[model samples]
Target chain A: MLYLALGRGAWGELLAKVKVAAIQARPVGGDFRHPGNIRHALELLDECFRMDDEVQVACFPEYFPWSGGDELARKAEDLGMYVIAGLAEEEGGALYNSCVLIGPDGAILGRQRKLNLGLMERKHFGFSPGRELHVFDTDFGRVGIGVCVDFWGPPNVGRELARMGADLIFNPSFFFIFREVWHCLLLARAVELMVPIVAVDVAEFPFRLGDKVFESCGGLSCIIGPPWRDLDDFASWWYEPKFNWILGQLGYEEGILIRELDLDLARELRGAWFSRLLGREAPWP
Target chain B: MLYLALGRGAWGELLAKVKVAAIQARPVGGDFRHPGNIRHALELLDECFRMDDEVQVACFPEYFPWSGGDELARKAEDLGMYVIAGLAEEEGGALYNSCVLIGPDGAILGRQRKLNLGLMERKHFGFSPGRELHVFDTDFGRVGIGVCVDFWGPPNVGRELARMGADLIFNPSFFFIFREVWHCLLLARAVELMVPIVAVDVAEFPFRLGDKVFESCGGLSCIIGPPWRDLDDFASWWYEPKFNWILGQLGYEEGILIRELDLDLARELRGAWFSRLLGREAPWP
Candidate 1:
């Protein structure tokens, strides 16, 4: 792991460069079913690897393959990649909407359950909210997950994760409403936390359920990096490539978005930014 | 008062429409001095009122006329408009950077001191971070102020104010760098809190002190409203007027930006949006 635990408190070390893939695939749960959805996601993952063999992390959208966690873990072990995907887990007579992190060794590393349940998830699906937030350590850096609205809503889980020293945040969302607002939020979260965000959302698709038709307003899966370290690099930070904080993004379509993230820069930025708040000297001049 | 506090927890009522003015003026502290900056600000306020006679609230930038609270309050009483301005406060043998809210009656309503001090503030000036946060009630609505970097920094005071039932927020800034990031943050704060933000920044100007010249990178004062309630109002929310969440804004020049804010719509949106998360029906279908 890039971060090591010292005696009193843990200090972070410079992280390795990470090649990440955010898969914008069709919905895996609800009327779409699971086994087939899981198969499709696996196929997409394989395709992503073929395109970029060095991809270290692969993220799938929320509720994609909402079950069948074992399959994802097995795939992670086979491909020697970190697999992050949303799952619907049943335990203690309660169902949870969760995002699970499967390690390269086929171990279920950990899971961050959705803390803020949405209206549909509460009223109709009877989903219970998660209690604790967790950060998982990886070879590249420490990472945290906030499922869908948990990242967007109040008591933002992303903020908590960033405060816990996560270098990067993964948001597995099955989002549909307010794309513009969501875009602004993603940027805001990246800036506020000083951490890059790997947000993957399910692709748009219409489905039929016993004469009722519903369409998913998913897609806009993106990888947003932290803000610029040197404002002097551009005359106006909002113009041209300077404000291009969205490192890589996919539209409302089914595909994979890949980007090589400099976790070292992100970690350094987060450290420098927070340290200054404590009346410490910033690393930059 | 537009909102009456009921028993148990305070229940909010719809607020009347309010016309607000955000004055973007030159720096008033340090080399610029006190009474001169205060005079300039008052003249700008008069000019704003002349432009929009019904302007009910006037906000000035941080540290501009940083020590003239009495004059601003008296002017507020004279104009019969609520005045919000930044002040360098001396209390308990400690000097603090604070924003004061003065009612139309010339009464000092409340003040929110800077909770997170900047490096220059702590090291160069020996400023102390404030211990308390406050919200002031007026005829239009309850409001909160976050002075400069306090609103932008971690443990954001703006978020706390919004959670404390502030219908609107005022950010008095003397910002110089990373304006693009600041813009995104303002919009994000508005959306996160479900409250509008009236952010007034000092206009850009150069000042000389002991043979050294320092220029202010101020301006970009803006009024950002809450996100649109209806997404279907536009085909693509990111395009044109829909994504133009910054209702009114000024460039890096000394001027006053005034706009009529429908606090009733803001209150309604906030209540409905939060209620939906708690499994209640949204007002809109």
Candidate 2:
């Protein structure tokens, strides 16, 4: 079992502030097997890097490409940033929906396979579900990744990650429809886990096979922090419009959203609200 | 351990449609021990019953009254309606934050003491938390109640109720602050549990103790149903202005919200989305 690294080492000290980006990409023209899909993903990654030089980490939509993992790692190494990208992998004759975490050193730090499978992934694509959850240690802080439906599962992969000492969670989803539902679910997860969430989905995707045509993934990448209020005036924190702390959000268009998150604020709010229920000590610490 | 009654019997056959009401009341002048608080709650109940004659079940906010359980039961029996009301209870020398269910026969069918407690409730009020989760079989269907923070808990009492065969869940909340957070959590619970949630909070409450003048418990009582889309076109469901199926929602004012929920639609969507993950057979069935 891969648990979160909880020791008060350099990582703990580095949990001050980090700039994160969620990249909303246009759908690749071809399927996962096509080289065009990988090329398109690389192009989007390049755009994200060019858009924000201060982004310490960038996340892409799910099922971008597994073949592009090494290339993404190399880019991360060159830019000195962490990269979380989604792809489908073939391991031991079984296909799995996965996301790869590449560190600043351009090393594949870890991979999180999707635990819950949709009907299309299971019956149409023959993808096997994942069995384990892992939290990765990074230069900035401990992070966890839940690919798409894993965040929607009743078992709550995000809550488990927070319990393991993850200050941040990244959800790479292909929400396709019901965009409002996606937003509501992400906010709920953030509040329950008492952590920050960077969830990205494809802006627009058109699936055409035989006589069927499916379009509109509704790309609305957003970043949500823990619920907080003004310490002195509790009423002002909720009534005042300025206290609405959705750091950044993107509309249904191909773009990259960058925001500097105050990890200290999230920590303070978590302590005030959830420390009693979740406990104060970090498991690994 | 209590599980949802899932067998296909007369109850299953009766799961077609039910009219429900969520009453958003203004805070009574006195605390739980005051007669004015009970009078205010009874008045609100009268108004709700008058507003919707066909409503089979009605829900009230948390801490509405402590002395009206018997009266509320008698009223429910007279009207032939199920009533779920929130109040504080003193039992065996312990104070509990609780909600009571009154059957159509005017009997106190069951009570759900809150399982989670906040700082004010635990420290200032010296209230002890409840230790059990239950689902009640009513004339309409299986229903569960979670007072305030239990709906916000990570374990998700709402999901447990849905698993226990509850077609509907009532969340009696006194969400004094963070109104948007309340909306997000309610929508998230509805989507995750695949069940309708009728969450009621005080319309507006002003507390004046010494120099502290605490005002505003924004009332935005709402009823949310299962996530659904048009079978012909998926994009139409989200993009169409009329597709937002929040039956009704109130602003920051005292009012009653009534909606007719199609349980058959919820059951269909649950079978389509959650059955694969949660399993088709109910444990109790």
Candidate 3:
């Protein structure tokens, strides 16, 4: 009764399930401003769409689109699917690293600009950090997005999204090093927030920048859910005869990782693990 | 100059190097209020002391000594080593899960009470939570301690300790279930705060609670440090010749995990990674 009251009644019908896909793309080489790079990115998007016809929402890696938001929106509209793609937007001579969520209606539902800037982004690219964080309401559920480094900083962007009633958080990252750190951080964010996370990372990309060569994105994209184990013994946890919670995971390769999230299970676990601790009316509610 | 200035001035001599140990002990069964359990805990402490004589600071698992705070303090003075051990304290008709740092001078330097309570703790034990967080300054460095569940919460207790100028955070955890979450959270807290962490977990202990028998603490104690790799290529971040930052780690077994931490390296990396982003004057400073 408490779960139903706190978990937005009509939990079964209103939030049935969502099939999501994370497209781990290989990094683009040559001039990033080149039109050919944009074409290559679109080709990857087409591949992702073809990989799974039932994927209601598809996510791409950070800075995948070179330009042309209108074309991307039109493509999302044609496919009748929600698409979250990361790109760099130049406005009034200032560039902001941003993630745009395009609705099935071909309109931009929301945009989350990267709040934290990496060393290279600040000194080399002159990119200005974003000031606001936003969560978008979609057909499946409320969702939030955070670009690569934004998820890495203190006052974690994912936690803020979880606080904003996001059932799922999408992290589009371009982490080129410390693959172990990326995996660990993703798990930390998921467990800490008690929310499902779909994190898409870039594949191994070797590129020369001036005199230095950069490689290794280690595309280990994954879909993580809340606590799935129940205590069978007072000391040990037992997870069996239940759902195989880890939907899908990929490692250091360009692939479309798709999984159907059990929204009901997420809500149930959140209630059992987090909500009950804080009393009936949870902070996220 | 910026690193030295932001890093509290003393570059080398004062905060040179520290050898630390995390002792993962099996929990004492029967009555938690038993005196024999306290003697058993002292035996484990003796084993840890015998394991590494060079270890300046050693940490024990949560709720090691069933009682006797003065005995633990006297042992630390006898060994001439700083010791952090977890125990439960009864004060003013209320029970609190606490971790006390015993100075080598046979004095109780400080005690950190567990801020968060687990489900079983709240329901079965009637444990009252602590309100304040404290960091202790030892001869080696500024140290902070968190008992079990306190380290698992968001706006991490370890991060708060780091903000309080704690160079090394000792997380004495009794995580019996979800071993993967424990490992990931420790790594996440370490990397996010850019501070070294020595997390001592309990070994597998099977005990009967009512009708069911639960087993597992899964020892896996580890000493993790700041970023170990220096980029061979600024853009690629490829490590050619680098020191492995994780000094030592133990599997799910009763053992002493010892590692020498280079304070200078931690301060340097903190400066390189975190300090430059927020200008020169860090909030921690």
Candidate 4:
């Protein structure tokens, strides 16, 4: 239960099903309006405190703010464990699409906003949306709140946060859009919410994603584990930025895209490879 | 009327409504006693008469007689055009998947037999489904026929050949089942038949679709037109004969991928870049 990730350059630990991290976006926009990206998010949380061991969970990259920084929520309550980010809220005057979460006693455990804005986020930087969705109870069990195109491919808000019983399911995305619509809509909302998706995107977003976009939102910062995970099984992950190609011309993806899901092979590739062949009584409408 | 094609490498060609060609199959072990590849139709009709130009119709890929050539209908009457190839016939004793349609005055302007034969063409040949369909009106117009998973993508026979009018729809494919089915189902059947397709595949057979099973079918040859083309235009023609590689390979791109169909900017990309606002109706259905 200690995975960890934050690609764009380098960062990985993934011992198996949990630890998770990931923060590669470098767009410098999204509300707080980049202050050199909060000094690169405090130099990326001082390198996620020398790469955690037991409990971790860094995550970021949906709004990437700092314009006001209430001491950046007291630096994730002094970086204890779960930080989870994505910002750009504005309350009354409008402009939402937030995320928040912070724990390990850093406070805040619930925020969620972002009800499918996308498509140039209401004509670039206007945000709005987030109507209902709160979920979190965490320790490790019932945590919820899907942001970023509200858990895409319409997995009805993570199947209504797994019918309001959520086991995990954070989301964080800034998916600049298009890449086979993020793997056929976020890997079919982590294989139709059986649960266990950590997701986080934005590995170097300053621009450019046109050559038939296969980037702008993928390195599959996935942590998802539940039915089907073996993109040719190589232990998982590829959205590298910060490192790989020597800072891939400054875009990002340092490192991190690991996997070890044995949550019963995600319930046997989603109940025997897609519930006896594309479940819900298959045969697409 | 210089719409020539007859390729086997990059992506084949054929337009009007849409036409792709190739049946270059090889695993005779799939039985039907292997026959029609006529030495890959005289080495892909001598590379389409060294880069075809005035054909108006040309295709071939399925089992071009399992590469056992000598007479590709006298090289389609010495390349006068109108070929539409694919073969593996063997009548009476059963074993169709054919194509024919010679013309350039060579005659036989029709023959189609391949109404879907997947799963190793229903276990080692002995096919049997294409009970009828010739549609060759000529002078470059009503062309029709289907084979190799008849334009698969949820049982679609090009809207029953544009509701039986078909201005052009030939498709002699081998779409290389492997090669990452190139982004799910041949670019969604060339953006759902906006017409003018020509998809051959089998640039280099002779075994090694990794020795078959689990996936083989090579080549990628494609050419989808109409919406003024851009499913990422291509042109290589042929390859897959030699080499090892950690990263070491080059040399192979037969020719002919031409597009120039300003046919009035494909009718001004039919109102809003085509997806159904189909201005002049992509050609029926």
Candidate 5:
């Protein structure tokens, strides 16, 4: 029972005219993972803070050296915008795909382990499904996190997250050229949540994940919400995704994908006008 | 108001199976139409009687003949099906897509033209919107007819038909591949009618229309109602679309797909199930 919606944005087929803040990620050895350790990762975090002083959150591509979780959680305190980046987790000689949300105070806010494992993902990295959705409270608002395939399950994951009090949902994705199904799923999730579900697909850099190196995953760093409240004022509104500098093919080089949050719309729209059809009673828990 | 409902058979893939007494249609040259010409079309009623004897009625595809409608609906009788088919009226050299229904007695039962159309369709053949949907009486029960795409517009076509007095509805559709969006509309129509609807897709021989062949238009024919049904002994316990004689795979060749229908169940589940939902108002017309 929360107020939420998404700002739908177009994806990049080719780069164009906007300036963007890009989070250039480098590999740290995956072998250096611990539940709570960080030295070199912290140094890397210092570089991220220095590069974008106003960055609220910096994202990383999937399957990078993810051992920096606890460290990013701490680094978020200094970075101020918080940190949500992907990392390959090492546990008991096995690897798991995971994304962590580090709080502005550098605390571990939430974690969502990838649920749908590709054949190679399951083989090279033994990933077990994440059991529950993660929605945490922050001074900014209630935020939720979900990895790629976790968003695809038919039983309404996005709606569930919205119902769990998420004002913002961060979806860090790695898209592919032959893949059209996932794009539709992302749009459906945004419509279902009716909140700003920022889906950041990797761009430019190609890295090998098994036999393939994906050079361009395409970028559609969108701010999805219901139709803009004032069509005339759309260009100037802070909540309007078009106004977010982090969007557009050209804008996201290294600037923050920023937008102000309004927590009330998710609350009032539930019953006053359009009934929550997604919340209709069904034969499930 | 007349009671009406729209129904379709499942997976009416063309010529996939050989049907025992399936109706085969050949594209005719002259104008073929039926509008308010009940006794006129019923003249060849005995031909259907000679072929199948107890056929009750047979259906044809949408716009079976290239008829000229402005000329007092010329060639209203040559429409092939005991049940009339959709027609494209050639006027001012422009085309108006339509569907007309004839009976086993060769009477014009009713005709409903399609209203909503897509871009490609609008470009190729012009269509006039169907303003209303109504049902008429028959020996079997109150029945109605609606063309393809008519169901897509608010589904009020079926609802209005049901409200008018249709216990059964015949919806003959023509499309290369079965669209899921149409299926969703069918599901919604069945749920709303609380009556039986026999949806028969225009299953026929593939040939050329203009540049398109008439017989080569592979069709999927079906008869869907309550997926399960219990009827009076005189009433058929089950209907089967076992006509598997579709040959050659232009990929559209699937034969008659029939399934027994249970109208009573529509009343049971979608109807007044005696104090269901803790006494909410009846949802159907």
Candidate 6:
């Protein structure tokens, strides 16, 4: 059929089912250099690995244990799982909010700089914005990271990532606003990109920049997938969008949220509709 | 100050408050040539005008009257309201799904052809797709129309329209699938485009193409607005996206659903955030 002809890659084997964990870590008194905070975040990662040995990927929200790149790299190697977490990177006397992805082999895979800097980040913190976007190949599939407002505000960042064949997108956010707005925006991105989004947010914390204290109402970290996957069942074609398709989520609390994603199913569902609708050789724009 | 600087047009006045009606119409039998169907649809339009003397714009679902161009122009002139409705156009032996906009002065303002054609539309019906997109300036503001699948599948059609400064989008659909899925897709479009979407769908009807009988599960006609408008209140910043921003909606029934849309507010909200985040003078991509 047209779907099979225009679909990406070969049907092959559906062997890319992956379990992911969102480590909703809390900040330690606005101090990324705090040894105790780094240690506590490491303990959460280790606990997550112990809780689910099958977990292949683990993520943390923005700037929690912010300066623990070496520790996370070591932990990923020790646990044999890919680790993605936010960082407050300082280079040449400039600060930029970033997310680092470490391979299971203990090597730093890559880092995605936050492209869209928030108002406070620019005016108060004097943060610099990133210029480019990237997608990395992993054992499970291709992955992309969108830090905080980078993915939420501009649809282009996430759209470009998905167009580059990102099977999954990991969003590290320190959203200080309402959680529902974030949820709605994230859900919309997931549906539009046709990619599963694993977004982890920091627990509610008081962020201090200068004399301004902004309390982040975080902990709506969640995983969202395509709703069209249900179309496989003939009856599901009549299903309503009344209910959200968020696979797993955490409320306003500090915890670890895990969910299993079927990358094969996502690809199939996305390919079938996009190919049929787009009628182009490429599955996407 | 930055928002006012980069926002579209002068914010000297916020005078545009448009009363719009979505005529959730039902097809009469299976023929567009049926006089009864055209008469019924026109009567509904008249009732809508009588009900709200201030109603500025009125819309109908795709292909309800199928081929009533002259009558709608006359009705728009008589009622002094802009009319947007779908049609089945036949040109040079090629058929296209189109939506026409009739001005209050009985002038054919413009027509937008469906850029994306569905599988059934292409194969069974031999319908051709349109090449260009346009935005029509009306009494209230700039308006764009996305016919059925045109606005749902691809993000560009709506994005391009929004980028071109469409304050309000009128989507005429004969969605035959599940209503919930349609709702979710349209909601995503409204949020992403930052434009108010008035989507009117036909009631449940059995569409017969040759011997194949396809039932359209329609009647999810609705008006959706941006959630960011609520940010005017400082407390609203904490409000969740839990409650839908759909101003008005109709269930699986034939009726006239009307709602007041503040185009001025939509532009201000979209510009404020887009300019702040995008940091560009255009306020859009």
lDDT values of the candidates?
0.73, 0.71, 0.69, 0.49, 0.45, 0.75
Tens-place lDDT per residue, model 1, B1-285, is 345652111235434578899998876553335568778767777787788878888998877767777888888888888888878889999988888888888899888888777555786567888878888877777788877766755435776786676778898887655555677777666655667889998887754434544454677999988556543432233223244678899998789999888777777766655555533322111
lDDT, candidate 5, A1-285, per-residue tens: 221122111331211111112243333322223333245446655765676565555555454335666566756776665677777766676566788777677777667777555333555456655556677665445667667545542324555776676666766665433123333444444433455556555443444555555543334444444444433443233121221222222122322243433445433432321222212221112
Worst 10 residues of 6 chain A by lDDT: A1-10
TM-score of model 6 (CA atoms): 0.84
Q: Write the per-residue lDDT of candidate 2 for residues A74-103, one digit (tens) a residue.
A: 888888788888777889999888899888
As a whole number from 0 to 100, the lDDT of residue B4 in candidate 6 is 35
C-alpha-based local distance difference test score of model 1: 0.73
Candidate 6 ranges with C-alpha deviation above 4 Å: A1-15, A29-35, A123-125, A204-216, A226-245, A277-284, B1-15, B29-35, B123-126, B204-216, B226-244, B277-284
* Residue-level error in angstroms, candidate 4, position A221: 11
Candidate 6, residue A118: Cα displacement in angstroms equals 2.8
Tens digit of per-residue lDDT, candidate 6, span A113-230: 8887756668865778877799877777888898887787657788888878788999998876535577767765764676899999988777666665666567888998765544
Comparison by TM-score, 2 against 4, better one: 2
Q: After superposition, how far is residue A256 of candidate 6 from its true place, in Å?
A: 2.5
Best by DockQ: 3
Task: Name the lDDT value of residue A264 in candidate 2.
Answer: 62
Give the best candidate by lDDT: 6
Chain A superposition TM-score per model: 0.85, 0.86, 0.84, 0.31, 0.65, 0.87
TM-score of each: 0.81, 0.84, 0.85, 0.33, 0.44, 0.84
DockQ of each: 0.27, 0.30, 0.33, 0.02, 0.04, 0.25
Q: Write model 3 residue lDDT over A1-285, tens digit each, in one string.
A: 212333322343345478898888775553445566566666766777788777888988777764667888888888878888877898888898888999877899878888777665677667788889998877677788877766754535776787777888888877655665676677666656767888887776664555665565457888877545332221233321222345678987778888888666676677565533332323222
- Candidate 5 residue-wise lDDT at B206: 46
Docking class for candidate 3: acceptable
Tell the DockQ for candidate 5: 0.04
For candidate 1, lDDT tens digit of each residue in A1-285? 346541112235434688899998886444435578778767887898898988888999877777778888888888888899878889999988888999878899899888777566786567888889999888788888988877755435776786676778898887655555677777766655668889898887764434544454677999998656543432233223345778888988789999988877767656655555434432111
Better of 1 and 3 by DockQ: 3
State the weakest 10-residue window (summed lDDT) of model 2 chain A.
A276-285
Among incorrect, acceptable, medium and high, the docking class of model 4 is: incorrect
